[model samples]
Target: MGRHKALPYVHRTFRGWHVRRTWVNTGEVSQLNRARIVSAAIDLIEREGADAVSMRRIAADLGVGVMSLYNHVPNKAALLDGVAEAVLSEIEFTDDPSAHWTDRVRAQARSFRQIAHHYPRSTMVVVSRQLQSSSGVIPVEYALSTMLSAGFDGREAVQLLRVFIAYIVGSLLREVGVTPTFAPVRPDVDVAAIDGGLFPVVASLAGELVKCDHDEEFEFGLEMLVQAMIVRRGARASTSEPPESGVIPSPGLS
Candidate 1:
């Protein structure tokens, strides 16, 4: 009988799975699965920004054929969604029922900042996508629940949650040098070269403007938001009395 040759990669026909093996120092092999694929996508995003994330690029990073990634990711949009979920899963949520609502909110926000700092370039994937997966929705559910427990009605809680996410996203975008148009910030301009006559204040604070302490500024904004929430809850409590008419004024102008 002739000897059979072992293939470098394998595809199981029964389950329609594609698997790749890589040699390790311990002589064991690691299988490339959806998790590994998503991780490679995140690595690409971190190194080359979100635009670099593609099935072919991730497959190259993982040392596999481009078609191999399709078995797991299916398409580019699914791949990006996976990246967002993976990054969000890194957040260590503190949902201690005994903790004060404000403390819980602060803990979640701080944890979010840590993840943002860890993946400055890839974090935007999370911000731009609506996280429908469990991993991404858990943090949001925690935030909404905290707001509700702190005495916010359903609409109020949703609106407050949107503002909270906006603050974090805006801060991280600035830290990562991404502008409103999603382009990288222009290289530092020479403030001294600017026309002092036209913009006196910008010239005067050039020293301070150039040396920003992002951490300190982030904390300042976070505390201000928290305090404002506290004040709002107190005011809502005091105004619990019903209006003469059942009509509740809309939250904003049409």
Candidate 2:
């Protein structure tokens, strides 16, 4: 059928799910099943990432029939929520909100990096999952609670959380080649063939170039982001005056 005919039914189905989400007051039993499937999903994702997880495979791995899964999960999209949560919870972060915001943020960012290290494919899921599920929101709250306690308003907290997490996770994704730890290079051709009259700087700097570790490099960027955020927070606090009454702020001018 054309989209014009399909659209109404699609909208109604989604509207129906919003009501199904409230089934049984809360998803207590479903949450417990999520705990199981998510555990298996993490292993599958580590081997193949977010795409590797399917209700069929997860149910098989858990030794439960596929129909049994529906009692706990709505569909693959909902199961993805569980997988993302399991990946997030793998990071061993302390939950005490009394810690300084920087310290807590450091821990939060580090934990996410650690999770991404193990489940590289789920990196996409970490920052992108919807908050309708409690599992998906817990780790986010872990980070936001620190910012909230640090006197950041809601809007600022969300902006910084996205910025910081994306910067850190994006940096980690760039280091994918080395994370699972590959073996040394085995060139198919003579190594000296490509060395004809090389750029002197690169030739002379071979030792330093070979010694560089991207994991260490990724951490450095995360450190710089944290420092820059701290500086921005301080600068905002030190502003001499607030905007004048009735003045509308222009975008991208600051």
Candidate 3:
């Protein structure tokens, strides 16, 4: 038998090879989604107020194209909503089921202040818009539920929740120097420059007021608000039912 010569195999080749597009890892892409965009916006807001939080600005901050942010945030309104949600979502609900309702209220209030302090400028986004999404509404729902469980009726609970929100938002805004309701104190004017002859009380207290400790002031106001709530709760209870044996009802109730 004659030995057959082995032929070398020739691999086929095509001209003009197209390069495969490189892609970011799934983990990286996921990390760069809504959360990342919202974080960048929050940073921008904290650094330069909410007015500086444009999609283009955030994209630039994140080193991405402006169009890339649209994938996560559709428009400026939605972006603001995202920022608001981010701010409100930091308010942690009370975890101890057996905690007193008043204590829970205090906890929520403190949590709100802490988060507001963390994102001082961005927190205005929370007050400027009504949250429609479930995630955004969780804090409100939790607070209302707490009020209702404490024996307040639905209407009372809703009103009380609104009052708490208004107070907290106003306090935080004032701390950030964005007082919309009244004239903010001009930091540039020296307290000693005020005329004691013209405005005696204002001049007298100017030193103390100008140098007041905000943390102490905030806690003092919070205690007053909590005490008022306690009083309201007690009044509601008094008016809610007949006096027990040997307990005389108040004149108004009687």
Best by lDDT: 1
Q: Which candidate comes out best when scored by TM-score?
A: 1
- Superposed by TM-score, candidate 2 places the C-alpha of residue 229 at a distance from the truth, in angstroms, of 1.5
**What would the TM-scores of all predictions be?**
0.76, 0.63, 0.73
Candidate 1 all-Cα RMSD: 10.5
Per-residue lDDT over 1-254 for candidate 3, one digit per residue giving the tens place of the 0 to 100 score: 33222111112212111112233333435445786787678878888888887888998987789998888789989999988876765554444447777677877788778878877887778878888975466667667877877778899898888887788878887776666322225556576777899989988887576664668877888877766666666676644544334434444332
1 against 3, candidate with superior TM-score: 1
Candidate 2 total steric clashes: 0
Model 1 agreement with the true structure over 33-114: per-residue lDDT tens digits: 7867876787788888899877888888877899978887789999989888777776755477677777888887998898
State the TM-score for model 2. 0.63
Computed on alpha carbons, the lDDT of every model, listed in order, comes to 0.72, 0.61, 0.69
| Candidate 2, poorest ten consecutive residues by summed lDDT | 2-11
Error of 2 at 110 (Å): 1.4
Q: Residues 1-254, candidate 2, lDDT per residue (tens digit)? A: 21111001111121111111111322233333655666567667777767778889988876779888888788988777766765554555556555556677877787778767767777677667775554456667777887776656789889988898777766666566523322123233233333537666655655554454766776677767666655555555534333323433333111
Global Cα lDDT for candidate 3: 0.69
